[model samples]
Target: MPLWNVYHPVGAYTAQQKQEFAADVTAFYAHRGLPKFYVVTIFHEIPESSFLIGGTPSGTAVRIMIDHIAHHAPDPAARQQIDDSLTRLLAPHTRDRGLYCEFHIDETPRDLWMINGLRPPASGSEAEHLWVRENQPVPY
Candidate 1:
Protein backbone atom coordinates (compact mmCIF):
# COMPACT_ATOMS: atom_id res chain seq x y z
CA MET A 1 0.00 0.00 0.00
CA PRO A 2 1.12 3.52 -0.71
CA LEU A 3 -0.25 5.88 1.90
CA TRP A 4 0.23 9.48 0.80
CA ASN A 5 -0.12 12.25 3.31
CA VAL A 6 -0.26 15.73 1.81
CA TYR A 7 0.12 18.77 4.00
CA HIS A 8 -0.63 22.18 2.58
CA PRO A 9 -1.88 25.56 3.63
CA VAL A 10 -5.61 25.81 4.06
CA GLY A 11 -7.40 26.89 0.89
CA ALA A 12 -4.48 25.93 -1.28
CA TYR A 13 -6.68 23.36 -3.03
CA THR A 14 -10.34 23.14 -3.66
CA ALA A 15 -12.44 20.05 -2.99
CA GLN A 16 -12.44 19.13 -6.66
CA GLN A 17 -8.66 19.51 -6.84
CA LYS A 18 -8.22 17.25 -3.87
CA GLN A 19 -10.44 14.59 -5.42
CA GLU A 20 -8.59 14.84 -8.70
CA PHE A 21 -5.20 14.65 -7.03
CA ALA A 22 -6.26 11.58 -5.05
CA ALA A 23 -7.47 9.88 -8.19
CA ASP A 24 -4.24 10.71 -9.96
CA VAL A 25 -2.19 9.24 -7.14
CA THR A 26 -4.29 6.08 -7.08
CA ALA A 27 -4.01 5.68 -10.84
CA PHE A 28 -0.24 5.90 -10.62
CA TYR A 29 -0.17 2.80 -8.40
CA ALA A 30 -2.96 1.00 -10.21
CA HIS A 31 -0.97 1.29 -13.42
CA ARG A 32 1.77 -0.65 -11.64
CA GLY A 33 -0.67 -3.45 -10.67
CA LEU A 34 -1.52 -2.42 -7.14
CA PRO A 35 -5.12 -2.76 -6.07
CA LYS A 36 -7.03 0.52 -6.28
CA PHE A 37 -7.95 0.25 -2.63
CA TYR A 38 -4.29 -0.05 -1.70
CA VAL A 39 -3.60 3.55 -2.62
CA VAL A 40 -4.70 6.03 0.03
CA THR A 41 -4.21 9.78 -0.18
CA ILE A 42 -4.97 12.05 2.72
CA PHE A 43 -4.89 15.83 2.70
CA HIS A 44 -4.03 17.85 5.76
CA GLU A 45 -4.80 21.55 5.54
CA ILE A 46 -2.74 23.52 7.98
CA PRO A 47 -3.53 26.97 9.25
CA GLU A 48 -0.92 29.55 8.35
CA SER A 49 -0.11 30.04 12.00
CA SER A 50 0.46 26.34 12.52
CA PHE A 51 2.55 25.70 9.42
CA LEU A 52 6.12 26.92 9.86
CA ILE A 53 9.30 26.81 7.82
CA GLY A 54 12.62 27.66 9.40
CA GLY A 55 10.70 28.73 12.51
CA THR A 56 8.60 31.16 10.50
CA PRO A 57 5.07 30.75 9.25
CA SER A 58 5.01 29.72 5.60
CA GLY A 59 1.94 29.73 3.43
CA THR A 60 3.44 28.61 0.15
CA ALA A 61 5.03 25.31 1.11
CA VAL A 62 3.58 21.86 0.80
CA ARG A 63 4.86 18.65 2.30
CA ILE A 64 4.16 15.07 1.36
CA MET A 65 4.94 11.96 3.35
CA ILE A 66 4.52 8.67 1.57
CA ASP A 67 4.64 5.28 3.22
CA HIS A 68 5.16 2.33 0.93
CA ILE A 69 4.27 -0.99 2.45
CA ALA A 70 3.12 -3.41 -0.23
CA HIS A 71 5.97 -2.62 -2.59
CA HIS A 72 9.38 -1.00 -2.76
CA ALA A 73 11.70 -0.07 -5.58
CA PRO A 74 13.95 -3.09 -6.14
CA ASP A 75 16.97 -1.15 -7.35
CA PRO A 76 18.37 2.32 -7.97
CA ALA A 77 16.94 2.50 -11.48
CA ALA A 78 13.51 1.54 -10.23
CA ARG A 79 13.78 4.14 -7.48
CA GLN A 80 14.67 6.81 -10.01
CA GLN A 81 11.73 5.85 -12.15
CA ILE A 82 9.39 6.18 -9.21
CA ASP A 83 10.85 9.52 -8.28
CA ASP A 84 10.56 10.84 -11.81
CA SER A 85 6.99 9.71 -12.10
CA LEU A 86 6.10 11.33 -8.81
CA THR A 87 7.77 14.56 -9.86
CA ARG A 88 5.69 14.62 -13.00
CA LEU A 89 2.57 13.84 -11.03
CA LEU A 90 3.23 16.65 -8.60
CA ALA A 91 4.19 19.37 -11.04
CA PRO A 92 0.74 20.72 -11.77
CA HIS A 93 -0.34 20.62 -8.18
CA THR A 94 2.78 22.19 -6.70
CA ARG A 95 5.24 23.76 -9.11
CA ASP A 96 2.61 25.01 -11.53
CA ARG A 97 0.80 26.57 -8.63
CA GLY A 98 3.94 28.32 -7.39
CA LEU A 99 4.13 26.21 -4.26
CA TYR A 100 7.32 24.92 -2.77
CA CYS A 101 6.95 21.20 -2.20
CA GLU A 102 8.99 18.61 -0.37
CA PHE A 103 8.29 14.91 -0.23
CA HIS A 104 9.89 11.76 1.11
CA ILE A 105 9.05 8.10 0.97
CA ASP A 106 9.45 5.50 3.67
CA GLU A 107 9.28 1.83 2.76
CA THR A 108 7.97 -0.42 5.47
CA PRO A 109 8.44 -4.18 5.49
CA ARG A 110 5.58 -5.78 3.59
CA ASP A 111 5.28 -8.45 6.26
CA LEU A 112 4.47 -5.73 8.75
CA TRP A 113 1.43 -4.55 6.82
CA MET A 114 -2.11 -5.91 6.71
CA ILE A 115 -5.57 -5.11 5.43
CA ASN A 116 -8.79 -6.45 6.88
CA GLY A 117 -6.63 -8.57 9.15
CA LEU A 118 -5.02 -10.35 6.19
CA ARG A 119 -1.64 -9.97 4.60
CA PRO A 120 -1.67 -8.82 0.99
CA PRO A 121 -0.77 -11.45 -1.57
CA ALA A 122 2.61 -11.47 -3.29
CA SER A 123 3.04 -9.02 -6.13
CA GLY A 124 1.45 -10.20 -9.38
CA SER A 125 0.11 -13.35 -7.74
CA GLU A 126 -3.32 -14.62 -8.74
CA ALA A 127 -4.67 -13.58 -5.37
CA GLU A 128 -3.24 -10.10 -5.76
CA HIS A 129 -4.82 -9.75 -9.16
CA LEU A 130 -8.12 -10.84 -7.72
CA TRP A 131 -7.84 -8.20 -5.03
CA VAL A 132 -7.15 -5.61 -7.72
CA ARG A 133 -10.24 -6.70 -9.57
CA GLU A 134 -12.35 -6.72 -6.43
CA ASN A 135 -10.80 -3.51 -5.04
CA GLN A 136 -11.01 -4.95 -1.56
CA PRO A 137 -9.44 -7.52 0.70
CA VAL A 138 -10.53 -11.13 0.36
CA PRO A 139 -9.39 -14.38 1.83
CA TYR A 140 -6.79 -15.92 -0.42
Candidate 2:
Protein backbone atom coordinates (compact mmCIF):
# COMPACT_ATOMS: atom_id res chain seq x y z
CA MET A 1 0.00 0.00 0.00
CA PRO A 2 1.18 3.49 -0.91
CA LEU A 3 -0.57 6.10 1.16
CA TRP A 4 0.17 9.59 -0.09
CA ASN A 5 -0.49 12.68 1.98
CA VAL A 6 -0.31 15.95 0.09
CA TYR A 7 -0.20 19.29 1.87
CA HIS A 8 -0.55 22.49 -0.08
CA PRO A 9 -1.67 26.04 0.46
CA VAL A 10 -5.38 26.57 0.46
CA GLY A 11 -6.97 27.20 -2.96
CA ALA A 12 -3.98 25.71 -4.74
CA TYR A 13 -6.07 23.09 -6.52
CA THR A 14 -9.63 22.81 -7.68
CA ALA A 15 -11.75 19.74 -6.93
CA GLN A 16 -11.32 18.43 -10.48
CA GLN A 17 -7.56 18.95 -10.35
CA LYS A 18 -7.37 17.10 -7.04
CA GLN A 19 -9.27 14.16 -8.50
CA GLU A 20 -7.01 14.04 -11.53
CA PHE A 21 -3.89 14.20 -9.41
CA ALA A 22 -5.16 11.44 -7.13
CA ALA A 23 -5.97 9.31 -10.16
CA ASP A 24 -2.44 9.79 -11.46
CA VAL A 25 -0.97 8.78 -8.13
CA THR A 26 -3.18 5.69 -7.94
CA ALA A 27 -2.34 4.63 -11.49
CA PHE A 28 1.35 4.81 -10.66
CA TYR A 29 0.92 2.10 -8.05
CA ALA A 30 -1.55 0.05 -10.07
CA HIS A 31 0.99 -0.08 -12.87
CA ARG A 32 3.40 -1.65 -10.41
CA GLY A 33 0.95 -4.56 -9.88
CA LEU A 34 -0.58 -3.30 -6.63
CA PRO A 35 -4.29 -3.57 -6.10
CA LYS A 36 -5.91 -0.25 -7.02
CA PHE A 37 -7.45 -0.15 -3.56
CA TYR A 38 -3.97 -0.26 -2.05
CA VAL A 39 -3.28 3.24 -3.26
CA VAL A 40 -4.70 6.24 -1.40
CA THR A 41 -4.04 9.95 -1.96
CA ILE A 42 -5.21 12.57 0.49
CA PHE A 43 -5.08 16.29 -0.18
CA HIS A 44 -4.66 18.62 2.77
CA GLU A 45 -5.25 22.31 2.36
CA ILE A 46 -3.13 24.37 4.70
CA PRO A 47 -4.13 27.87 5.61
CA GLU A 48 -1.73 30.50 4.30
CA SER A 49 -0.90 31.58 7.81
CA SER A 50 -0.07 28.07 8.86
CA PHE A 51 2.17 27.01 5.99
CA LEU A 52 5.77 28.09 6.37
CA ILE A 53 9.06 27.99 4.51
CA GLY A 54 12.26 29.46 5.94
CA GLY A 55 10.14 30.51 8.91
CA THR A 56 7.92 32.63 6.72
CA PRO A 57 4.48 31.82 5.39
CA SER A 58 4.64 30.44 1.85
CA GLY A 59 1.78 29.83 -0.47
CA THR A 60 3.73 27.99 -3.17
CA ALA A 61 5.21 25.18 -1.16
CA VAL A 62 3.78 21.69 -1.11
CA ARG A 63 4.75 18.76 1.06
CA ILE A 64 4.12 15.09 0.49
CA MET A 65 4.51 12.16 2.84
CA ILE A 66 4.27 8.68 1.40
CA ASP A 67 3.96 5.45 3.30
CA HIS A 68 4.87 2.23 1.52
CA ILE A 69 3.75 -0.99 3.15
CA ALA A 70 3.30 -3.67 0.52
CA HIS A 71 6.44 -2.89 -1.51
CA HIS A 72 9.83 -1.45 -0.75
CA ALA A 73 13.14 -0.77 -2.43
CA PRO A 74 15.64 -3.55 -1.77
CA ASP A 75 18.75 -1.72 -2.90
CA PRO A 76 20.15 1.72 -3.57
CA ALA A 77 19.42 1.40 -7.29
CA ALA A 78 15.84 0.41 -6.71
CA ARG A 79 15.41 3.24 -4.24
CA GLN A 80 16.75 5.71 -6.76
CA GLN A 81 14.36 4.38 -9.38
CA ILE A 82 11.43 4.89 -7.05
CA ASP A 83 12.52 8.43 -6.31
CA ASP A 84 12.91 9.22 -9.99
CA SER A 85 9.51 7.79 -10.79
CA LEU A 86 7.90 9.89 -8.08
CA THR A 87 9.66 13.01 -9.32
CA ARG A 88 8.30 12.46 -12.80
CA LEU A 89 4.86 11.73 -11.44
CA LEU A 90 4.80 15.03 -9.56
CA ALA A 91 6.22 17.25 -12.27
CA PRO A 92 2.94 18.21 -13.88
CA HIS A 93 1.21 19.18 -10.65
CA THR A 94 4.14 20.91 -9.01
CA ARG A 95 6.98 22.06 -11.25
CA ASP A 96 4.77 22.81 -14.22
CA ARG A 97 2.53 24.89 -12.02
CA GLY A 98 5.32 26.89 -10.35
CA LEU A 99 4.91 25.15 -7.00
CA TYR A 100 7.74 24.15 -4.74
CA CYS A 101 7.35 20.56 -3.58
CA GLU A 102 9.21 18.21 -1.29
CA PHE A 103 8.35 14.62 -0.61
CA HIS A 104 9.70 11.61 1.28
CA ILE A 105 8.72 7.95 1.33
CA ASP A 106 8.72 5.72 4.37
CA GLU A 107 8.61 1.97 4.09
CA THR A 108 6.62 0.32 6.86
CA PRO A 109 6.94 -3.36 7.70
CA ARG A 110 4.33 -5.25 5.72
CA ASP A 111 3.63 -7.62 8.59
CA LEU A 112 2.30 -4.72 10.62
CA TRP A 113 -0.22 -3.67 8.02
CA MET A 114 -3.76 -4.97 7.65
CA ILE A 115 -7.00 -4.25 5.89
CA ASN A 116 -10.44 -5.07 7.25
CA GLY A 117 -8.69 -6.86 10.11
CA LEU A 118 -7.11 -9.33 7.67
CA ARG A 119 -3.47 -9.43 6.66
CA PRO A 120 -2.97 -9.13 2.91
CA PRO A 121 -1.80 -12.06 0.84
CA ALA A 122 1.75 -12.31 -0.40
CA SER A 123 2.71 -10.29 -3.38
CA GLY A 124 1.89 -11.90 -6.73
CA SER A 125 0.16 -14.74 -4.90
CA GLU A 126 -3.18 -16.07 -6.19
CA ALA A 127 -5.00 -14.70 -3.17
CA GLU A 128 -3.54 -11.25 -3.76
CA HIS A 129 -4.54 -11.45 -7.39
CA LEU A 130 -8.11 -11.98 -6.25
CA TRP A 131 -7.94 -8.82 -4.14
CA VAL A 132 -6.67 -6.92 -7.15
CA ARG A 133 -9.52 -8.15 -9.29
CA GLU A 134 -12.06 -7.42 -6.61
CA ASN A 135 -10.42 -4.12 -5.67
CA GLN A 136 -11.10 -4.79 -2.00
CA PRO A 137 -10.07 -6.99 0.87
CA VAL A 138 -11.40 -10.53 0.58
CA PRO A 139 -11.10 -13.65 2.67
CA TYR A 140 -8.45 -15.87 1.24
For every model in order, what is the number of clashing pairs? Answer: 1, 0
TM-score for each candidate, following the candidate numbering: 0.97, 0.98
Worst 10 residues of 2 by lDDT: 47-56
Candidate 1: clashing pairs of residues: 1-70
For each candidate, the alpha-carbon lDDT, in order, equals: 0.95, 0.95
**Candidate no. 1 TM-score:** 0.97
Residues 35-111 of candidate 2 have per-residue lDDT tens digits of 99999999999997899888999989999999999998999999999999999999999989999999999999999
Candidate 1 residue runs with Cα over 4 Å from true position: none
Please provide, for model 1 over 1-140, each residue's C-alpha lDDT reduced to its tens digit, 9 standing for 90 to 100: 99999999999999999999999999999999999999999999999899999999999999999999988999999999999999999999998999999999999999999898998999989999999999999999
Which residue pairs clash in candidate 2? none
Query: Model 1 — which ten-residue stretch has the worst lDDT?
Result: 111-120
